[model samples]
Target chain A: MKSHTYTLRVEFGDCDPAQIVWFPNFFRWVDAASRHFFVQCGLPDWKTTERERGILGTPLADTQAKFLRPASYGDVLQIESHVSEWRRRSFVMKHQIRRADVVLVEITEVRVFARRKGDGSDPHAIESVAVPEDWRAMCE
Target chain B: MKSHTYTLRVEFGDCDPAQIVWFPNFFRWVDAASRHFFVQCGLPDWKTTERERGILGTPLADTQAKFLRPASYGDVLQIESHVSEWRRRSFVMKHQIRRADVVLVEITEVRVFARRKGDGSDPHAIESVAVPEDWRAMCE
Candidate 1:
């Protein structure tokens, strides 16, 4: 599959008192990278998807990450994201965060396309939908 | 081992365009819960640890999280955190986030006590140290 790269600069606020990027910030960046991948793949934004297709967004089911090296503020990082696997109702996204040639963190997430539950139950409830063929074709 | 519960109110900014809590914020909360657990266990703050014992902080080596349910703004959430296992140099911290009686997310992190490399290498470099017996005793 084709991969997309998202570049970002680590801000001072992103770092913990220990002077290294707080681990949670890595998740935030990867989440952004995941969205950027879809955008770069010619998929519409979540707002557009919701209006046109009732697809609210891709929500994470699970995620795993390995922090190889610590990154500090003032560092420039690149996150390379791609879909590694696809299921009926879920897909796996792999992201590698790198500083130059060195990998700082590696992350994988299982995510599902979700929409509002239409069963007249809880209005805020959401349910996953099957992988959209068009979306998959664009990503792949 | 004893567990600690940290409570916080979800704010509007934590939500995404779908009006649900963005997944990364769950990680941020759990990381705070991890620190709160240590504080409640009678362990000194990271600054004190670094000054007194050369122990900087617990840095994550790896982590996994499962998102069970989605939460939104105005929800009051509780994160329960504890150390689940201890290795020679690394320990596992587990966290569960709940809204009322419903579990929203579960997280497990493998972390190590880190300290600055004293040798004349990169000043920003850190190395893992063996789990401190006193700190482990305090937590247990």
Candidate 2:
């Protein structure tokens, strides 16, 4: 029921040659918003979780986004993110990018709580784990 | 039917605190791969197209990605991108992120050839235009 809003200012580097905010930059902001939602809900950092239970962080399994309007440099956008669902080993995060009263983009992502396959040395080896009850409780 | 492969070496900044390639960075690479596909196909940059026909760039209308494996700094990735379909005002691009022969991620995007609206002054005013025949020919 609770949501977190992350504010960001579009920078020159964030735009493309067309002088509009590149679409990928929206994803960057969304990823940050996802993390901010958990942090705002008082969950421990990923490092602490990894140390305690081998949970590295939330990695996306599936992601979809729709772009409605264009944004350019100097624009300030707010991304509101919240948890929409929690599965056995995954959760869905929903984000809406807005400027004032206008919604510019919408995104929904399915992410899993992952852990290192071995000792975390092999960068490519990681697997998802069951949803942590404490994490779910804190987020919800 | 021709596909373009964009090779990139993952950098330190491209990763997140978890020391893995951030999901957003994948989108960034995908954007570049999209442009690279056009350039490799002999089309001019977006600026030229904008000046010639009010075509700014291919802006994403919808995108979906599935992450199959994780990548980290110092890894090398090759994104093979090609236009899979050409619609009236939009096109679909398919991209596969690979390392050597291993598939790391897959993404498909619906993008439009967009132009500035209302004399190009208002940053938020932009809309998709019909796919240019010349542009499509070059890409195909």
Indicate the worst ten consecutive residues by lDDT in candidate 1 chain B: B116-125
lDDT of 2 by residue, B80-127 (tens): 999999999999999999999999999999999889889778877889
Could you give candidate 2's per-residue lDDT for residues A24-138 as a string of tens digits? Answer: 7898889889988988999888989889888878999989999988888988899999999999999999999998889999999999999888766887888999998988998
DockQ values for all predictions? 0.68, 0.83
Point out the worst 10-residue segment of candidate 2 chain A by lDDT: A116-125
Model 1 residue runs over 4 Å out of place are A119-124, B119-123
TM-score of each: 0.96, 0.95
Give residue A72's lDDT in candidate 2 (0 to 100): 88
For residues B1-140, write the lDDT of model 1, one tens digit per residue.
Answer: 79999999999999988888988888888878988999999999999998988888899999999998889898999999999999999999999999999999999999999998865244359989999999899999
Please report how far candidate 2 places residue B136 from its true position, in Å.
Answer: 1.5
The global C-alpha lDDT for each of the candidates, from Candidate 1 onward, is: 0.91, 0.91
